[model samples]
Target: MSDRRATVVRDLVRRLLDDADGAGTAPIVQVGHPVLRAAAFPCDGQLDDADLAQLVALMQRTMRAAPGVGLAAPQIGIPLALAVVEDPGVDDAEVARVRERDRLPFRVLVNPAYEPVGEDRVGFYEGCLSVVGYQAVVARPRSVRLRAHDASGAVVDEVVTGWAARIVQHEMDHLRGTLYLDRAEMRSLSATDRLGAHWASQPVPLEASRALGFALPTPAGPGGAAPR
Candidate 1:
């Protein structure tokens, strides 16, 4: 880590320790926070096992409490390259078919990186814990090859597809100081309540994409393979 990044990590450690006693969720830093804009420092074994484990646990708790699929360190105001992801698994058959979501065991990623596995893309409504209260139509690669370390510093390398891949990309972008809105159809952005009220049933609305001057993927047949 650079001197500046080291300083940032030191400050983060102090802040985390100060709040260690607090109850409830860790405060998620919002869009305009400087920490969210700056590229996070690579963990690179800088944090000892105990501290690393504690931080990962805190992040997992915060993410579950938020009821979100993923969380990145920057979202909780830590400028470190770390993230946690889990999906209790989607139960609705239709929802599951559309999203290709499945049960994902809780996993930790440190100093992570990913690359698109194919030209295929899936466009869907995505919201963020940090962004809060809005959802937008953003398209991302449907599969990715990931490389990272577990909380114990063990190497992790795998290919992930479907909803899990989207979660990975979203969280990784946080560490890179990017947001879904940066790649979303701005005109298709909608309030959370409004989405549930009017757009919840549609996988991807054609009218919304037309209004936003973009085309979304055409749905494959029932039980068909994911959009390519």
Candidate 2:
């Protein structure tokens, strides 16, 4: 990340800590907390080896227990640039088909970064563990090239697509002090209950965008598009 961005993240962390005034650890840090907005530190060699492994294990367990596809270290009040992601496959075939949701085995990413892979863009309603109870339509590149390290500090470079790609991007954004809300179509933002009641079957609803007074991005043709 750029130095300016890093400084902004540090400021955010300071503000959050000031507000908390030395509170105990919570199950998951929520929005408005500095940890969630601050850039996390690279974990490689910066932490005790055994301790890092334990933290990774705890993050994985917490993610699964939260019933989320991914979790970042900052979400649990740790400021290390670490995240864990896994999808145990969806049962709803239509939902799976629309989102390209598929089985993803457990994986860990440390100090991750990603770039757009192709021009194809897909819009989906995204929710977050930190920003609970709300979902919003966000268009993202359909594929990405990820560069990062695993829990053991091995390099990980690969092309990721479909829902897996979305998961990766979301977690990486956390590392960079970005949130899905920063990229979401404000008009498409809805409560989870509202989404289930009305927009459950839709892809990206133009009506919602219209009502929200924001324009959605035009879909790009098959080539590399910018990251969301």
Candidate 3:
């Protein structure tokens, strides 16, 4: 059924994009959509090679256009276990160092999953394209072991750390029908403007936690500090 459904979805998305005023992108579905709340269908050979490539290309274009670090299929009204992630990085060396954020090349993840590598946790402000206009602080594992198939159906298994790990975990959560807000410290939610205006200077979110009157998990191991 998923395989047949994949064909239907691919055709539907193409038509939707065609009608999107030649922008070559589709509208990202916002939060509260049923598709975003349901577990996505696994992408195990559901799409043939050509169809898979086309879908990946469209997803990449949409993700780049949204100007987000990552995007999951459910975010676009396609409930498939797929996502694209990339980060060009910030120019400020101090900020990058504090957040452990570096240049991350664009990559496609199919049926991706991850597990925490250790007990250490770090809290940082996170926002989703689906949950537009808001950002919140969430604590997550500082390192994780990622297991997935690449665009070419090759296995990918490795340990990712720092900001990269955070990106992986966030996207994988979408495949499992979860959102950042589900795990977020609710009190720390802030409007996008307020986040930049009030908490942008605080790198690790510690100050926001303090000001917001919320508790943050302590770093349990090395390289674990308050990150931007």
Candidate with best lDDT? 3
Worst ten-residue run, lDDT, model 1? Answer: 219-228
* TM-scores, one per candidate: 0.89, 0.80, 0.92
RMSD of each: 2.7, 6.5, 2.3
User: How do the residues 1-228 of candidate 3 rate in per-residue lDDT, one tens digit apiece?
Assistant: 555686787676566555654447768998888988899988866667876777777788888998988988888887789999999987877767777888999999998988899788878899999999999988899899999999988899999988899999999899888999999999999999999999888656778887898777774344355432
Off by over 4 Å in 1: 22-24, 210-213, 218-228
Candidate 2 lDDT score at position 39: 83
lDDT (C-alpha, whole model) for all candidates: 0.82, 0.77, 0.83
lDDT of 2 by residue, 122-201 (tens): 77778999999999877788899999899877899999888899999999889888999999978788999998887776
Model 3, residue 147: distance off in Å is: 0.5
Kindly report which residue stretches of model 3 are placed more than 4 angstroms away from their true locations once superposed: 2-7, 14-23, 220-223, 226-228
Greater lDDT among 1 and 3 belongs to 3
Model 1 has an lDDT value of 0.82
Q: After superposition, how far is residue 1 of candidate 3 from its true place, in Å?
A: 3.7
